[model samples]
Target: MALTYLRHQLHLHRHKIIGFFLLALLSSGQQTLAQGKLKGENLPGYEHKRLRWGFSLGVNASWYQLEHSELYVEAIKSNPDFSVNEKTGIGFNVNFISSYRLSPDFVLRAQPGVGYHSRAIEYKGMPADDDNGIAGGDVTQEMNTFAGELPLLVKYESKRRKNSQMYFIAGVKPSLVVGGQKKGSEYLQVKSLDFAVEYGVGLDMFYPFFKFAPEIRYSRGISNIHKPSPGMFNNSIQQLNTNTITLYLNFE
Candidate 1:
């Protein structure tokens, strides 16, 4: 009898329960839509400024792209163990940004900055030496550099979606070595000037006071930066190009 009574109660309240759930779902969806619309309205017309200024802090991982000389290739035929290995190095940078709005979807930017970088190349199966840390018949050459960077880029932006917009940037950067190489011990040498092409993608977040962006960029050098020296390790490399990946946090 209690089961029959329970069944009758469920049948009578089923339509009311369904209505309650439907109302709750509709209310939740409407609230979500309203919040999204509100978010989309943030920083309206922020991109219409003729000029803007900002700054960025970044961390970078850098490595060398190397081409072996013909002499080195011939040497490798006789000694297969003769090899050079590039090790990735990490560094930091800071940039002051200047931007000009060309259109709603496009902007021009220039960033001038300074960075400190370290990179290493390992020579395997080298002659054992007591003086230069090659006691085990291998030597690692580490280069630490401080450089000034100037980059000019074009940025293309997507339509804003809820408080954030996506963008793509492509540019060229020219750098000059400011410091960080000590004179003496001559295993490897690098030129003072380097130029690279850079490309990246970022998301611009709108805030009440300012804008913020987090970006990831790739850089590739078009010219060889290696300077030839009178050393086996230096002569073995025909070309050395720069390759770096950087993650940046920007504020405007």
Candidate 2:
């Protein structure tokens, strides 16, 4: 039952991601078309400077990778029919950007910020969706990871067209969890440190005063955040992977 709900939500969010990409595409296409008629630059002499600073605000959806153990399969055989499902959590992103111009086509950037990340994996055997603790309707165990994130990225931009340009970025992000909470009765102990490689694309629009970049990116976790524990709940999951998709609005 939880798996079905999660699939529906995934379908919905997939469309949202597509919507962002389409908007960026349309906006870029118009700007590119306008360049054929207009000769002047959109924001004259915007990237000539050697150094720039800005900040970014964004929203993200977080996911998890759940692998069932042998014990999990055996336990399911012994107990009543049950299955595990994962849900993506809605979160926010805030970053301070410091960038350096390596050339007309390349820039080095560091985006350091705090992110609110959350995910819930439910054991489907509950009565009510409310926090009665995984007993019968759709009871989920929620885990929160409040961490400080530092991402070092290299951004590559295409040639400017009517002050609008497209760019791609790739980097490594390392984080340390500052705090976290188990919101319900169930507790899952996750590690405090995480590291991942990040990559994405963005559309850069030049305004008279500032540059705005609407970007989307994905980050995958290489860490297995689970520890050895002697319970059906903890023993069920063999590996846990982190996944995040974020859409950022950056102003410089």
Candidate 3:
């Protein structure tokens, strides 16, 4: 049932979720036909430069990859921990990029960013019917986090195809999280720092003045964020880590 509900939710947001692929496909088709009569290469001299700077704005969906402990499964079988669920949430980011060209096909980049995110975890169990728990239903704890992120990335670009090029990037992103309910909540404890590895692909479209890149990335955390909870439902969680997918547009 939960999987079905998640599929339905993804279906509702299909455009947002799959827009990057559609754009990439459309641009690939444009590359073959649009460059036949162009005067010179796209961004004629931009790639020759050594230092470049840019800014980006993006939208993201953030969630957790939860790993259940044996205790949690046992607790469920014992009927004290009925079900545990997670719901991903939308997020936004603003970033500044500093780039150093390493070669025609490779570049080193550092992008520092700030992001806002909200994610929820639902824990359903036999309620004690007390103030520590929700009165009427399953306990849903929503956490809003402000993240400071620093990513060191390397970009590998394909040869120019008309006014567009495709690139792949891989990097490490370290984040410091703040302003979450973890500080005072009776349930749902999370650590403040997270580290993740990221990989992505993008299409770079060159205009007369600047370059625009539409990118999609998938990132997974290497560090566990879950902390043991003193309350009933939170105790059932053994491992929780970050999972996120982001779509970005960069102005460079």
Candidate 4:
């Protein structure tokens, strides 16, 4: 009787062990199925990551002027036409963007980059005909300036479902006068700190691996670049200021 009791006990233990394994298998299978369903549901929402480093190349019609220069006004007369002819030129900019998605509607980005700009001013007549002309000079004057610039911009991206986005940006750009010539001779020696306040609007287009941003910005110089002079008619010259408009291409 004791042997029969032992046999029944062994059989009960075996049945319990089998039941536990069956329950474990069912639970594991259910979990796997649930995971598969969740993956399928989320597959469509997953987007590929964008690149962090990119290059930009485009053309810029840049304008450059002297800031609060009495010389310029004396050169142009009381009319004080401060507008420099738009120089049709080209520039290249490269960007390294750190993009973070704050929410579905907002993406914050920081971009720091450098660029090249060229500008020129052509005059219609020789200064010798007027009192402002260099003594005994009869040649028309043309000025060409080349600058190197670095810009930092913080842009606010708009919320939209389309491939394009509109942004407003405020930034600072410091430029160095690399080269300048008037009448084929050195004209103006600029300062080391050429600082400007930059504000602009931009458009960005999204692609699979990269984004293209084209921007138009206006910059106003804070410092007076004009050399002070003593003359009753120098007020118009002293009022001359420097500003610029830039077209830029950004990629990231």
Question: How does each model score on TM-score?
Answer: 0.80, 0.81, 0.84, 0.54
lDDT of 1 at 88: 60
lDDT of 2 at 175: 83
Best-fitting candidate, scored by lDDT: 1
Cα-based lDDT for every prediction: 0.77, 0.75, 0.76, 0.47
CA shift at 30, candidate 4, in angstroms? Answer: 49
Candidate 3: tens digits of C-alpha lDDT, residues 68-154: 767667767767547778767777789999999999889999999998766777777644536664352466777778899998999
Supply candidate 2's per-residue lDDT for 140.
64
Clashing pairs in 4: 68-240, 70-237
Q: Per-residue lDDT tens digits of candidate 2, residues 1-252?
A: 343355456664545754765576567657755754565566687866689999999877787888888877876786556677677676778999999999989999999999988677877752222342433444566766678999999999898777787899999899888877543235565677888889999888777678888888889888887655544456678888888888888999
lDDT of 1 by residue, 1-252 (tens): 332244335552323433443454345445544656776466778877889999999877677889988877887788788888776666778999999999889999999999877777889986444554334357778777889999899999998776677789999999998997655335678888999999988777777788877777788999899887655667688899998777777888
Off by over 4 Å in 2: 1-40, 126-138, 183-185
Per-residue lDDT tens digits for candidate 4, residues 102-179, read 555444555555544433333333233233333322222223345566666566667422345567778776766555
Superposed Cα deviation of residue 222, candidate 4 (Å)? 2.4
What TM-score does model 3 achieve against the real structure?
0.84
